[model samples]
Target chain A: MNTTIRILRYGDYDAMQKAGSNIPATNSSNHATSTAPEWPLWEVFVRSKQGLDHKHVGSLHAADAAMAIENARDVYTRRQEGVSIWVVESKYIHASNPDEADSFYEPASDKVYRHPTFYDLPEAIKHM
Target chain B: MSYQPTVSQLIHLADNALILGHRLSEWCGHGPALEQDIALSNIALDYVGAARNWYQLAANQINSLQDKAAFPLNAQGEATEDTLAYLRDAFDFKNFLLLELPNGDWAVTTLRLLLSASYQQLLLQQLSTNEHADVAAIAAKSLKEVTYHVRWSEDWVKRLGDGTDESHQRLQAAYHELWPYIGEFWENKLALPIDIASMQAQWLAKINQVFEASHLPQGVLPTWHQTGGTEGIHTEHLGYILAEMQFLQRAYPNAEW
Candidate 1:
């Protein structure tokens, strides 16, 4: 199955300032001298229970991975929604270029045989 | 020797948790970051929950004592947990001086939490195995939460102490400011299960390890350490805290959600 992921990119500091987004930069040192020291963004994923795959829940900012994990626990798991948390630096996530979307994903859409629905199962194959 | 916590000792324990939890709750909306805001609030909830448990136990003990003594009832004689918490004045509270101080900055707040949680973890660990069943049970339940609090604060201590020049300086300043209050945790004659002196040593050693890892200097015993919160002598901050915290209960007696 093809899953479409939306990547929300925060604009650069200058652009953000021009856009009137009052978000402060994350770097504490820069905070003294500059108005834009936002901490790096991290994408948060949570596993609701044991044996479940981690699903992307939301995003947050932190100084490091350890901080990010703790932050994710605080923000996402407060209501006991997650048994485990995974946080990745947003910059580290690789994605197929949006400009190549047609060439990259269109071919898969035409390959009907690639899907399980295309196959006819025997009546005796109960599990299948 | 088998140790049984007296009513006063139980009240002291409950008061410390209640006051510190109130201080932490002040950070609910004002944290440096959104995630930290939630984290601090969660910690505040844990502390208040622990306080409620301790207060409930204390109230039970108080009520039983009143029953045995046939004590005359005062105008506000109920010994419920809410009465103990909301009706008590600042002079009646027994939290550590360290916990009552304002949240100065992120560095100050983080370091204060680190120091207090370290002591609480050790104290609770000892209490979890106490001879008193109720004390042991409450300590055991709170130990898990305190353990996480220590871990969370310890990481921030290390991160800030070693992160940047400004961070290091800010953390060092916070240490200097907060170090004097650490003595209040050890000084006192509570006929409790654990030996506080030995616990203080362990607390120092753990603090030293974190300081070494973070490249911050170990705190020296100050010439004059602040004291007396455990004895119901508090800094001026406690009154304000009580005023804010008890406002609802004070305004509407027996008000319930």
Candidate 2:
């Protein structure tokens, strides 16, 4: 039941291999003994008291999820803006490549028919 | 009958909160991490807020009594929270010895908070049902804040105690240092609203449970129990705390923000 969390840098394959492939460090504060590794970054989302969904507040560093939530509470909810919080490890979030934006999204920009604006409206469609 | 006991009880509670809040506030910008730094400050503010409430109540109680000759007063000739807090010397303060001790490290601070918050939770719960309306209301309001303090400290104690060998050792060391002073919480020198001794068993049980969860040692007793902080006899540490905390007020008498 070792609780020592290890952070692996993506490019440091040699060090990762040397440390035995993502296992928990045998000792807590292992980072302290060597070069100090920063705590993992967690993206914080806060549902404001009046909001229906959690909104991205900001990111903070924390050792784990529980710590992340507490950190988020302290950092994001200091003004009582939040009714709830959600935290996800920053590394887990995936985003579309900005470099491929033209090929990925430009094709839909001129396609007016895709927006349903070209369709004729019914006479009884009052809400629309 | 003199309202001496009620005033003393209120002052004792206020002193504990003020001293410990000041201690926690010392970690404002210097915590191990940014998030934790803000967290500690938030908790410190809570304690200070509670201290103000208790001090105001104490001041009111003292003013209601006949012995106005000894207490400090403002221009309007009424005792105030500021006067009680800033004017009193270390010998007049009745805070627990455990609180006035230096915040050694993150482990020590969190562990101490856990222990004190647990005791306060129980004490406040009992006081919330007290005969006095003011006492009950203050206790009820303070209890909510102390509950979160307990949770935050408990989580840290578990993490530090169970996380690494070094962390565990540090926590163990803090436990050894702080254990002796815990006896003063149950000391019955004051005519408090409730039986202080009666809360000891529950407090111990809670401590033992947390210790077990944290992978810390349980059943280890201190060689000797420290006492007398409740009776105005304090450790040398309190004088320094007062000197720093009351410096502005003491230097500039009747200073107003």
Candidate 3:
């Protein structure tokens, strides 16, 4: 027996490059000699309280994961807005390609049968 | 010991917290990284919060003892927390000299905080068990905050000490520069639950643990340790700190936010 796994890639880097986007090249060496280059960006998620799902708050730059979480706490949770925090490297986060948005997501809008709202239910079934 | 700490002793403790908090706040927007900038500022806020508690307690203590001949009154004939913080001169401040030293570099700041936080952790731990109810309560509250401060500084100490040759050297230099002031923290004669010898031993053990983990040298404390901060003697740095911190209050007396 053989097993198969599906892998999806997001953000067309080649197309983005061809379009001459403003995104900085990954390994540029044209920085000033006096100061070190900025650290990588991290996306921050915060859970406002226990039993709540983590929601995307904002992003910050940090040297590493540990620093990223700490930075998230300082920047996002300082106002007691979060009881928990999550940080992901912006580089590691594969965002959906904006150029392919219509092809990828537009078809789902036409699939009206997938909605549970179409089901005929008794008058007492309020939640369904 | 059935000893009760004097209002002066409480004032001294408050002074230490306020001065250190002010120093840490200096790095609010100037931290090497944005994360670090926030972290340091958060720590500064905690210090200020703790100081407010102590100063309030001290002020209450002073007010209660106002009828006593030993208590002295200010020009306005009151000893409020604000008066203690803003109206006091350099010679009257009881903070340790270690805290007043300028924020030299990241390494120096981290090491200094590590040392101060370790001592404060032990001090507050002992105070939390004090016979006095108010002292015990304040210490109990501060202990929670100081515990994180210790961990944060300890992590930075380890990171900088074992990070690289340049970082290691910078940390070592910080340790040397800060070692002398460590003695002043221990020399306080306050009538608290703290055993100077025991606190010293515990502080040294904690420092040694970090040093071992950081692969830094140990047993470098000077034979002749600097003292006199508790006696109201301080370095020139305290003058500058007070000048900036107390400026608004001094300029606009009785000004309310």
Candidate 4:
């Protein structure tokens, strides 16, 4: 299956909430009149100063990507762990079906040539 | 001549952070959302952390003062952070009245943070350049935390003010409820080392921008402003806050973690 990534923006919240098809309304009440609609779930990725890749940290709820980044900072990087943050709507994330694992991954099981064990390197290659 | 911060001045700063931090801690498990709960708690921790720094400096100042009779020192033991925070009576607390009032609702809490954080951001910016190394260092560190706080609170205020009719009304009411106490931020009744009144124009300009963005009403400002928190006079609410906060230590003295 092919996965296409779509960037979510702040203005998209109103449209998503208006559609109200699958998104659940939050039961929490902070406003005086009625319960507020639940914020969209966002998956947070944080890049540490020491590392080059943005690693998956955790998920949080926020109204928009801007708020998601701030929430991620407060929740995930409270100890100064991250130098950069990226937040994507959790709904946009695609995962392979667990039931199809045998069909999807079993083909690679017999491919022994993928391993580099056949290569004979000089003994001087210490780091490798 | 370089300006030296007095013990009262440091205590004033400590009291503001400690009271606001305590108020924010009230929403620890009770925030509207789990993420926001953690966010507010993080902010509370930052305020408490800043308060500890100020109180530590204040303690040192109090201990080293040549004339102990000048300022009213209320701690039973050495003027440690714990003693300054827990041992002081309600009358000794110098936090603004806006901080001690109960966090009414999400709107109230958000607006309060926005207002107070705006003033604190300016105050800390000035103090960060102070001649005193400790004061400057603490203010510089706290300014970073407070800059984020102001941003977070400003975002909420705009969201709530422009959100729904219910949200707009609630935020407007919160503004009205919190308006009078805003003036005390400018009043340096305790004669602190920093010039707070000079920052009033900047604070207003910053808040007015938020107000404009949020579509909150700008007219009908309060004529009479509430003051006296700097002089250690506070509303009845501060007493209750002290009673609850001071309970553990008052019940068992010399207790340590």
Better of 2 and 4 by TM-score: 4
Pairwise lDDT winner, candidates 1 and 4: 4
RMSD of each: 8.3, 7.4, 10.5, 9.3
Candidate 2 lDDT over B1-257, as tens digits, reads 32233788899999999999999999987877778889999999999999999999999888887877588887788899998999899888999999999999778899999989999999999989887778888999999989989989999999988877888998999998888898788776786766666687788888888899889768444556899898889999999999999999889988878
Model 2 chain A poorest ten-residue lDDT run: A28-37
Worst 10 residues of 3 chain B by lDDT: B66-75
For residues A28-52, write the lDDT of model 2, one tens digit per residue: 3432322124688999999986637
Error (Å) of candidate 4 at residue B224 is: 2.0
User: How well does candidate 4 score on lDDT at residue B182?
Assistant: 87
| Per-prediction TM-score to the true structure, in the order listed | 0.83, 0.84, 0.83, 0.85
The DockQ leader among the candidates is: 1
Residue pairs in candidate 1 whose N, alpha carbon or C atoms collide under 3 angstroms? A25-A37, A25-A38, A26-A37, A26-A38, A26-A39
DockQ of each: 0.35, 0.32, 0.27, 0.33
The lDDT of each candidate is: 0.84, 0.86, 0.83, 0.86
**Tens-digit per-residue lDDT, B102-195, candidate 4:** 9998999999999999999999999999888999999999999999999999999999888889778989999989999988876687775677
DockQ of 3: 0.27
Give candidate 2 regions above 4 Å deviation.
A1-37, A105-128, B1-5, B195-198, B220-223
Off by over 4 Å in 3: A1-36, A117-128, B1-3, B67-76
Collision pairs in model 3 = none
Q: How many backbone clashes does candidate 2 have?
A: 0
lDDT of 1 at B250: 87
lDDT of 3 by residue, A74-126 (tens): 78988899999999999899888999999999999989889987768998876
